[model samples]
Target: MSANGLVQIEGLTPPGNAHRKTSKVMLLFPPEWVPTAPYLALPSLTAVLRQAGHEVVQKDINIEMYDLFFSDTFLFWISGRLDLQRRLLEERERRAALTDQETDQLALLREKCTVEVFDLAERAAEAKRIVRSQDFYDADKLEWALNIFREVMQYISAAYYPASLVFYPMESNLGYRPGVSREVFACLEDEQVNVYRDVCRQLVLPVVNREQPHVVGVSIGTQMQLLAGLTFCKMIKQAFPHIHVTVGGNVVTRLQEEWPTHPQFFNEIFDTAILYEGEHALLWLLEALAGGRPISSVPNLMYRGTVGVETNKEIYTEKTTALPLPDFDGLPLDQYFVPERILPYLATRGCYWGRCTFCDHGQGYFDQYRGVPAHQVIEQVLALRDKYHCRHFLFSDESYPPALFKKVSQLLVERNAGIKWTTLIRFEETLQDQELWYLAAKSGCCTLYYGMESANERVLNLMDKHAKKSVMRTNLMQASQAGIWNHVMAFYGFPGETRDEAEDTRRFILEHQPYIHSVELFYFVAYRHTPIVRSPEKFGITIHKQPEYDLPLDYYYTLNEPGGLSCLEAMEMAEQFYQQDFHPWAVRVNAREHVFLYISKFGTNRLPQIYAKPEDRLRGTDSVSGLVTWPVALGEGDGNKEDGPTMTRVVSHASGG
Candidate 1:
């Protein structure tokens, strides 16, 4: 123990339980559903637990699981064959145009065939020893995940029908951003399911037998993580009858407010559930468990008993300023893998302007926003830098309240905190304070990720996103002028958007190409219990109904009524927009050296000329051959018919106008 005579923070030592002798806690990091990036949440939570005088051991099941599924040589061979089959199916679809009735029937048949193929893909992916055999895998529960994936795919595919055709696009939200190939999806799904099952077996069983802690806590983020957490909890209870299990994470926090009261929920897993920010709720639950007190008094806990779930008072306590900064020393720093080891620090919780209709923060769970004191933030940064040698800091605030950002920026400057950072901020707020931007740059702010959900004013209004498109554009331009990289987060296929609106978004991207460094897009997923999900009819969309306990990873609905794009058509349009406009722009901008050379040779004036005749421009004899023709005058009789008067004026006017 330290000088304070508390329990020494070290390795896993089971907690104090009445029935179990050894007391240990195991913290698990779930598999990567979106990207194969390093797990940070587990390490951060481990740091917090260690600081609280609890011995914590973390297991990143994602990496191990990924390796087990993808690294097998035999599986690659099988996956290649699956890809060939999928291509054949696509080719067949392209070669024929069926009547609407025939199209509907064929779509159903195609869905069935795809489901069967996915099942085989999942099995082949899990064929390795680390995930399948009893020695490394749980023999009885191995098929549990395979079954779940098969059912989820079938259910979601059937529910959404042809509309979900765009589920796997060429580019996605993951870091790799490669086309969603059939083989790749098979490989990823296999890895996700296997990792979850294997980790649950290894971690949960060990904790159950050797370290039956008072509570088994699972952290969830994505749908895959939620499934794994629930399955693991079920297994834990089966193995150790007396132990109670709990779950808390972003997914859980979002779901628990209007948490469904299905029988499957109580019969399947988890004795108690914690919703929203779990630090305080978990601490209170642990205290009650250790003191042998009743669980009903525990705030923010949903307890499941013989009768039903008994939820305690929803806690909305004031944010504690004195909460200690997460201690990173206890975690395996070397094992942590990200594109960059971005040390995450949250200056606040919730959003200052939580008005977005689709955002969970504006809902019941995360309504309050709180900021940490600037002095404390600086101190934490100093500790992170000195102790862990961190270089890049990722501020994980909901919106990084502008006032707090200003204070923190000033403190960083005052304290000489040499830390490079990136954060999420509101465009309107950034425009409101230029001094904050100046100070932020002085304090090593490298990038600002701005939320501009849609460029169309009507779409933004429907989504309850308060910021105007005009303000967003102006702020983005100013941010570029301030020498800060701007990453725009956009969404497509909101309920009321039309094909025309999507076209407008595409146009907006082209018009403001200079300011946006990168773009991230997500197709809307109607989350359960949200106002959008509950009252989608009011938004002029039909909500597809699914089974009570069934939560689909890619749940979507169609805006088939008057003012919206049909779900399938909207998705196809969005995909086309990405491929035709957004992606090409990203490719051009990201090729920095090439873009620089082009700009230098042709000047900005020649950009329109190059874009107009891309085929000819690309076929130049050499790089210099392309550069030599920049000053050529285009008279009205010039053979460039595609270069209309409007194009010529756009090119010429920019030179002076």
Candidate 2:
């Protein structure tokens, strides 16, 4: 409404014929891990665009991306190649069993293999090397693995769906491993180039010909994701000249600081580079395209031309609260393959405690916390419940601030808007109020995902987590007492972590098994933008003398502690611990019940029964709360105090009878 002539929403629309718009926009989510659902970015962006009257279609390319590479055809090809290699090995073994002349003949036969077969053989050899070596998993070597994966994907794409809209999924620094330095990570440019070419030939060309979307937008969340996005954009431009392309998201917000001098950074593949939050920028770009206005003149857009890329001086308002809750109704919700279709909601942007050293969000743009109003949040919850039957909502806030949680909890209780939810919370903040935990439970809060990063005090200090082991333990116990399940996430293999320290963490988990519902263990990988990655020497750790683009696996280094596990070993141990203690089935059960219990309580017309027994009511409890307090019987003094001793106990309580 200010500059681009786009209409902004003021009040609610009465149920009637809303005028339909003609502009078509396709939004793409690149591939990522199967279990971890893609962040719900496009729905919010689409809602904004739709409010401004644009027909938007979203595609989650993750399933397709996985399918393209892991299909039966691709598997069969790999299997056949493996068989050929096996046969060659067997022939050599047979030759070893025979005369030297026979062995020489067999070697000659192997040398006479075709180019394609030889390439397959080489790939098999490399795969064997990858399986055996510790260095293969490093952050710097991730690109090498990705390149290998890309080739398989490319081969499959050529054989199958040629001309699909290929969106490269975002990659974060978490996937990086040890041994690989940043410099080695950067050297995999050629592999990325090949990936781009394959994407163009196999996907972009066909989609452009078929659907002819007016504009294609690529989202970049991390630096690695940005590289993939840039690659896709260049391919899109070269293959399909008629369509407009745009780039936005977390990476775009910091692009100016990272690469300010690159010409066509705003141009070439991208007609417009959206800055800040993209909802407004997207609408402006579309209007410019449809109305035939100069692309360079669009607000919140940076463009390129004869002189250079011109950035408008217009400062976009960060305080716009008129935005709609993400329209998931339009998205392919069922297409999302997860144990539960997690409804991700952002109550606020930025962190309440922005003092954490390792936080990129604290240092990045939108550093201040801006929360959506309570009424607005309730409205969105109602819409999700009524329309999509969504009962489980995950707060995607950096930290679900205590004040906001209290308000939301109270509102949910008052309105009787029953919904089970989980959020990341500070240990001390939640522990300070028992009422908060009780209210959270009454309002159907089932789980609290806590980032109890380490058991070691030094490691915690280095990370600036501002938490103590005792505080985390107490909060976890209180949460269990409040009937709220606790999911403890721990980071092992931090820079200064010793074997004894790792064992102590393991021992701690064993000691507090009853209070904690599940534990997820992760190996620490230094992110490029983080303080630890920047100043490794401060913590007596070595930063890899490599480029920022390199993956973690390439720069492997050892800990100073005697008999201490390397980063790779520590990561594997943590993964094993997670598998043993917090299996996938447990997570699924928690996630599933998180929604089902809430919906059962709210959707049907019966008042939810809070207590599990009649005696609970007799105990003068208003309603039976299913608070899961750990019996003090399992603690240090009350139990057989020997370490590493396993015992099973069956206890009967009279209160719940």
Candidate 3:
């Protein structure tokens, strides 16, 4: 058992053919996600299954893979793999000329091999310590630690050339298109570039072998995690043919229409897939697997029958008010890369404003929107806070509805919850009250992410956002003046949007740059299920679908008229905005959790020290200066002496201790 009484199962004796009342379920959260906190899906599913009197062992292999990457054992293993690859390339060169790519890779391998593995491993371990201890509050130490993580990822990426593995942003590509079914299947079997296969063998298979679970469910939440989640499923199915393997999450839900035709994916990769909300659907599936109910009666399930792939008739949507608090038992919460524990809680399901033209996030839900009342939200928040001994939270809501936003803020203030929180919100006119922002900040609202998709009023009308420039400006001004960090998300391209309209957005952001603390700019994607793609003619665009992308959720597109920016122009505009106008939001701390902690620690949004120095930006990378390859030594400071200004000491009574 762990220190907090959470069950820490290393292994279990193999289950015999004995009968039991409840099934043993092993829930796995795969890699390529943010490693700072536990995802809410596993805990949400685990809560229901355990409440139904079943056994569950929830493993977060995402954080484990990251944890493993920076360890002495894994680094030494990477060194050996690099050596083996270098020898193989030398042997190939003896017979034939090396390809350009192979020649460059061999040079990289030799250069990386020169770094002292023992020293790197020691620094890597220390980096983990720095992030998990009081040293994290020191910006200099924390920056050095984060650089070590990036360097370690660079070393590991050399083992699998052309994969382009990365540490942050979750953009690691294994040189395979996840949207193509054949390439997806091929990626699962590739021995050379598929790092997830090794991750599964090292960290996942042993637990499955020892626990002998009756069901293994993998949650593939994002496109980056699809390869890793499917790899774990395929390997589990191969090792134990009897264990029922299932996959679900937002990405899986997006591809629900394509799963029925992919029979090879149904039986070979995973036996079944749960769609939409999975709490009760998965529980009912367990009942079916246990012979208590007919398999056809289970809701939101897709499986292969004798006639081929079969989806159940009933689809399930969860009621937000009726659900239990997400149970985070059996997860190694302390192992996250933060000094304090930040728990994720969902107060609402689905986007409240479900009319964005370029969004497919609403496709994951069968229903539009539902939320718990403010009273119950506070009760649950207090319960979770006291029970876990944590004061920080990430409200994982799609968008904080205006009514609940005010009431929840009032309750947090009146009840004195002592909780620091952050969530995504819409720029509603109802939130125009400046006092509301202050109340929220007093109630410990450290950051708010807004989906200000476009500042052009005409473009906003086209996208169905309908947000007024006045309200958007007021929201940013009030929130920032109240000392809350404002993170604004905007994209450059939309169908029927002119170049002048896109420039309007750029000018507005630059004019209001002080209010917007952080920004995420991107070119719009023509998602497969969005309203724009459903009626391309209405948006004056044509979506070009590739035949190979049979399981596609997004597409390339072209404008039907000539006034708007082309796809290439949109890409160039976004790139230029970052290169020329993104200095104000270029943060040294990029991760959301890291930024949240910094905001909470200082109790303000104007964190000058956290912003990158002008010279640092000129260096063209976010790592510690001169530490990319090899450095003679790391600097030492409390971020006060010669590094920068001294940080205000705030007592963070968080749960990681």
- Per-residue lDDT tens digits of candidate 1, residues 73-96? 423333443355445546666888
After superposition, the stretches of candidate 1 with alpha carbons farther than 4 Å from their true spots are 1-23, 33-52, 63-195, 199-214, 238-243, 257-268, 314-318, 338-340, 361-367, 429-438, 535-538, 552-561, 585-657
Better of 1 and 2 by lDDT: 2
| Global Cα lDDT for candidate 2 | 0.52
Output the number of the lDDT-best candidate: 3
Model 1 residue 79 lDDT score: 44
Overall lDDT per candidate, in order of appearance: 0.50, 0.52, 0.79
Model 2 is weakest, by summed lDDT over 10 consecutive residues, at 637-646
Which candidate number maximizes TM-score?
3
lDDT of 1 at 209: 72
Q: How does model 3 score by TM-score?
A: 0.91
The regions of model 2 sitting more than 4 angstroms off are 1-23, 33-38, 64-207, 222-232, 252-271, 287-317, 338-341, 362-364, 430-435, 457-459, 493-504, 533-542, 547-657
Candidate 1 residue pairs that clash:
13-23, 13-24, 14-23, 14-24, 15-23, 15-24
Scanning candidate 3 in windows of ten residues, the lowest lDDT window is 648-657
- Best-to-worst order by TM-score is 3, 1, 2
RMSD of 1: 15.0
